[model samples]
Target: MRVEGLKLTPVSSAGIEQNASEVASGSKNFGEFLTEALGEVNQLQNDSAKASFDLAAGKLQDVSQVTIAAEKANIAIQLTMQVRNKMIDAYQEVMRMQV
Candidate 1:
């Protein structure tokens, strides 16, 4: 039996430090993230609507495609609504807090 030369090297300290920094500063502010997420949801809804219209007009052949798209859009909208409700609740709570 012969074993070939095997070498495994761990990540460098500088690489680890860079990765930590990236994780710490990579994300946008909460409001910006929310805005971007809502925009994505809006886009999904628009796509769903377009797919449904295409299906209705006999332009799309697969009913399943339209159904899936619609369901995704519905779920995204519901999630967005829930997030909005939570944000409102948080804001109200903060307002009620004694400063």
Candidate 2:
């Protein structure tokens, strides 16, 4: 399985620092951040779907790889749902507040 498109790279400190700077600088709004995060989750799901389909079609050799991809997509979706729930709770609490 020569996965040409799936190359894993080490997470460098510079990348983390840049992301932090962008958030701290307000270059990206909350909605923009949320949208990007959701887009990534969507991509994960799509990749997982492709892996699953390939597995069923016998195009994929390793079942473990498909399993891992599905799990990764599941976790991403779960995290996104949790974040959304928290945001909804915060909004409702703010609405209830007598300000």
Candidate 3:
């Protein structure tokens, strides 16, 4: 059987390096990043709620859009919960470590 090479586009490293530098310089630390992420998740939940309200009030005709928004919010909440659980576990582990 003959095989052909699959073509792939080159990935950019400049943006990645810039983000790393920003994090390393403390201008945008972990707390700020976490806050921004949580804010985004909250926004998604608000959007989902609005979409649901609009659909119920007959302002929105697209049910799929409401479903998509709700699913996005649900996924974000699940991810945030997992991250919180992991952080708690890590904190506990550190507390248990001998100084």
Candidate 4:
């Protein structure tokens, strides 16, 4: 087996700052982001289901691939839930603060 060195790229702080500013300025639509995230979750679940069905029908040759797909979908769902919980908590905290 041949091993290849991994190539890594450095991220610039300027780009990150610019993105943060854009987000704060409402240049990007928050609803679009949420919609895209939900769409991704839906797609992952569909893929996992298809992989499982294909495996059960003997249409898939690799069991590991199907398992990986299912795991990916599960992780995505869990992460989405955690983000949602955090958002709710943040909102509540903001509401509790008085001007």
The model with the greater TM-score, 1 or 3, is 3
lDDT for 32 in candidate 2 is 93
Give per-residue CA lDDT, model 3, range 2-68, as digits (tens).
9999999999999999988987887987898999999999999999999999999999999999999
lDDT of 1 by residue, 8-93 (tens): 88867998888678668975566787788989999999999999999999999999999999999999999989988998999999
Candidates in descending lDDT order:
3, 4, 2, 1
Show where candidate 1 strays beyond 4 Å: 1-23
Candidate 2 TM-score, C-alpha based: 0.82
Q: How high is the lDDT of residue 47 in model 4? A: 99
In terms of TM-score, which candidate is stronger, 2 or 3?
3
Candidate 2 residues 1-99, lDDT tens each?
775787798877998899999989999998997899999999999999999999999999999999999999999999999998999999999999996
Q: What is the C-alpha local distance difference test score of each model? A: 0.91, 0.95, 0.98, 0.95
Residue 63 alpha-carbon offset, candidate 4, angstroms = 0.4
> lDDT: which is higher, 1 or 2?
2
Off by over 4 Å in 2: 1-12
Q: What TM-score against the true fold does each predicted structure earn?
A: 0.73, 0.82, 0.84, 0.73
Candidate 3 residues lying further than 4 Å off, grouped into runs, are 1-14
Q: Lowest summed lDDT over 10 consecutive residues: which window, candidate 2?
A: 1-10
Over all chains combined, what TM-score does candidate 4 have?
Answer: 0.73
lDDT string, candidate 4, 1-99, tens digits: 999999999877998899899899998698889998999999999999999999999999999999999999999999999999999999999999999
Give RMSD to native, each candidate.
7.0, 8.8, 2.3, 5.0
Model 3, residue 24: distance off in Å is 2.7
